[model samples]
Target: MPAQPSPAQSAQTQLERGNGPEPSTLDAHRCQEVACGNVLRDLYEGLVTEDAQGRLVPGMAQRWTVSADGRTWRFVLRPGLRWSNGEALDAGQIVASFRRAFAPATAAPFGELFDALDQAQAVQAGRVAPERLGVSAPDPRTVEFRLNRSASLPALLTLPIAFPVYLPAVRRHGAQHTRPGQLVSNGAYTLAAWTPQANLQLRRNPRFHDAAAVAIERVRFHVTEDAAAELQRFAAGDLHITEVVPPQPLVSLRRRFGAQLRLSPYLGAFWLGLNTTRAPFRDAPCAAGATRCDDRALALRRALAMAVDRDKLTRYVTGLGETPAYGTVPPGIAGYTPAQAAWSDLPQAQREAHARALYRYAGYSARNPLTLELRYNTSTPHRRLALAVAAMWRQTLGVQVRLRNEEWKVFVQNRKQRAITQAFRGGWIGDLADARNFLAAFGNDGPLNWTGYDDAGYRERLARADAAATDAARNAWLRAAEQRLLNDHAAIPLYFYTSKHLVSERVRGFQPNALDRHASRWLSLSP
Candidate 1:
């Protein structure tokens, strides 16, 4: 638990944060967006949580132990635990939450996080009942997990998918259980009020186990998707922290705010996901009497990937100290080295020439341009990036590019369905500091596998990685799997992400970490 706040810290307890679009739902099980996860972090506590430095710490579980084989873990809950509604919270409830998250009816988007658990895959596929999951509550305060193989389970527990839910409220309200008045949270804060497109308010949870250490009594998350508008709000003193800093006015912002401007390496990747199940990208027969019998779809995808100049995109468009990425997983992950594209080392002129040749081989030329749509969510940065990429495609490969922007909810839905999507903007932020968190998403049956990427060899390598007995063995298999994905051109890795925010000088305890998670409970405002 954090130390108790001083008298001065308690005086100005109200905090206003400029945030992105309104979360589609507060239900942790169904959430897939980073913005939604931010709110969920405050409303629920899993078996483990992260501190200001993003280090894993005890949450609901005060202490835990792992077996010699490393396939079984037991956690002992904190004493006198109670929900925000004043109901007793025990190990049984935690077990129930795990079952609910894996249940087929729930359709949890991030359910892949639990794939290491014994029988978790079978339970999610409806081959077995949810009760057959590896989690069991042996006693009122003791919960145990049985895994089929060894994994970083403690770090995985810090994710929202492992957080417990109030079963009684869920039963009574169904999907509406997360509403302000009905939500029964177990974290440092509770939902007080929510106005769509405006703000979502939370108050300190009096029944929280560490309430004495919570500094902020009230927190208001103001929905402002546009970075320019968020910056205005922050400058007007209506916001203590801006969700993102617009790339256009970054120079001015740095000059004005100086030390208040926060920029840190974020463990995420921004990329273009080609719908491998749809036209223009799906595996198709090569042209008749072609010199090479390679898959034309693969050639087209690779051509598009090679045409983009990622260095220019990062230095000019984003301009926020982001690293140009040639692979799915970002750098700096412990025990792993990321894989790069085969053509990553080619000179720009030579790369463009090679892309043109591949484009022609794919049966598209200046006379017959390959027309396609690029879809992205509405955001200033997204629009600029999309436009730049479209221009690059048109210039390098004689492709007709169409840009389509949709709201957050609609864009996510269309991208997930993949019936009409051609090439869409996609990204993933690591739930833990493991390369598996990024590589596993491309698995054939992965919930986050939006690209329809399915390869028998790739899946086999991932399976071997998961069952490996040592870190070296696991990372070797993981690296081989990533290399296969990059060679196949499943997705175009644009650049690694860097979190850019403008935090007021008055906000204390706002530490920058690789995960970019800053909960209001650990923050206080100076008057």
Candidate 2:
């Protein structure tokens, strides 16, 4: 077991404040990838947290009081927490930083994610003054949000990136200077250095209220794309954490360092998206029909779901600690419940009948077969899963899928283009724990709704849920919307997610959450 840190340990006093270069901007709005996100996290803090179970919890705001109507929340900021540059952390900064994020020039991918904030949409549209943005820090120690509606307030606050407190110092520097050392942050750790494509170094932030509790004096994030290379590097003691490792290597790790090989799913679900606006998919009856394309897709989806052999996949693809997914929501989130319908093996005769009927409906002659293209990233485990799925589709649906492979970057771009591939694989980590996060992707105007399925009735239901007055009522509408999605076969649910990490024996007091925030506030290391 890793040696842990105590909450009251005297924080390292040798560190100097603002030892790095001065920043041109203190904002985190323009960062693009995971590496940039890790860099910016050090400088910002949010009001809520997505815990290990993918549940929302209080963050910088110790707690909040909500009105019965759910339109307002009074957040009490933690006292005496300061940014690394010595500015007293206050509510005014939160208001200013968020206002800047809404600016069109900032082009923040998360600009819409914060629409729940008071007057946020209005402010973004230039209809309101930035100061009237609904977030008021009446005093240096307090902040309050006047919301537009009632729904997942805390989860909305736990976005994966940005939402950090910004200082006036950053607005002057602007987006151009918002690099690693150019800014001061208010999180559990501070940026030590970032060597491109190598490692990102972070050390404890003395100004953080809970800094005394941080266990690791220095943390290093090594960027390696290959799973086999990552595990080999881990065994050689070259890295602290390696993610998305392949199954065969994971088995060897468990056999050798059983306790160190941690296993958990991230809060995400992989699925096959059908471009409902194009091709045979565009024809609603054809899409929903028992004909070849529709029928083959449904049978293939079901057969693939049932034949996945989740236990084997979990043991190999995920290294255990993962549950087979029957729905979009992962197992541990508050509203997630497994669907009553289970996918089990069908009799060979029935399977053949279904496949034949589907092919016939798809307009295929008796001798012809329905074929489509499938695309996935080239990760070793993903390769295995894709091959398994392809094989299952062939045997059960009698449909042959041509597998297309690409690097992670290219594959993502292809999906965005709605390219030639018929079915593409992907998942999203819940930015917050709302069912809306899942259902919204299917909504007509959902920003991330890559599937391009537009259902007017479903869209209305989503709007109603968003406008509901109570969490209970809102969640009920959201669940009904989910049922509609399931009944419609909008997308196939692959598996719920868990994050996996392997901590060294010397690293202590580490806590992993589905939101992927490293809560080192209470961590400390033994000498």
Model 2 alpha-carbon drift over 4 Å, by segment = 1-43, 49-59, 79-81, 110-115, 119-132, 165-175, 249-253, 264-266, 284-319, 335-356, 364-371, 398-410, 417-422, 468-472, 512-516
Candidate 2, residues 1-527: lDDT per residue as tens digits?
97765634423311111111112123466543343454454545677654434456667888888898787888788877688777787777776776676665554555556666777766666677777777777777677778787655666666533366455556656553444676567776776776654555677787877666555565555556556666677778665556555456555668887777666546677666655555544443455545554354444333334434444555555655666555666655675442422332454456456555555555654266557677886666667777776776676556567988876556656665664656767666666655667666677443356566677778778778878767677777877777666655556666666666666554455466666555434434443
Error of 1 at 501 (Å): 0.9
Maximum-lDDT candidate: 1
lDDT of 1 by residue, 1-527 (tens): 98976856644787888878889789988888887888999998999999998988999999999999999999999999999989899999899999999998888888887788998888888999999999999999999999998887999898888889898999999999999999998999999999988999999999999999998898998888888888888898889998888886468768999999999989999999999988899986568988876588899999999999999899889989888889999998988989999899998888899999999989999999999999998888899999999999999998999999998888888988888899999988888888888988788555578898988899999999988878999999999999999999989999999988999988999999998999888899888
Supply candidate 1's per-residue lDDT for 434. Answer: 89
Q: Which prediction has the highest TM-score against the true structure?
A: 1
Colliding pairs, model 1: none
What's the lDDT for candidate 1? 0.90
Write down the worst ten-residue block by lDDT for model 1: 4-13
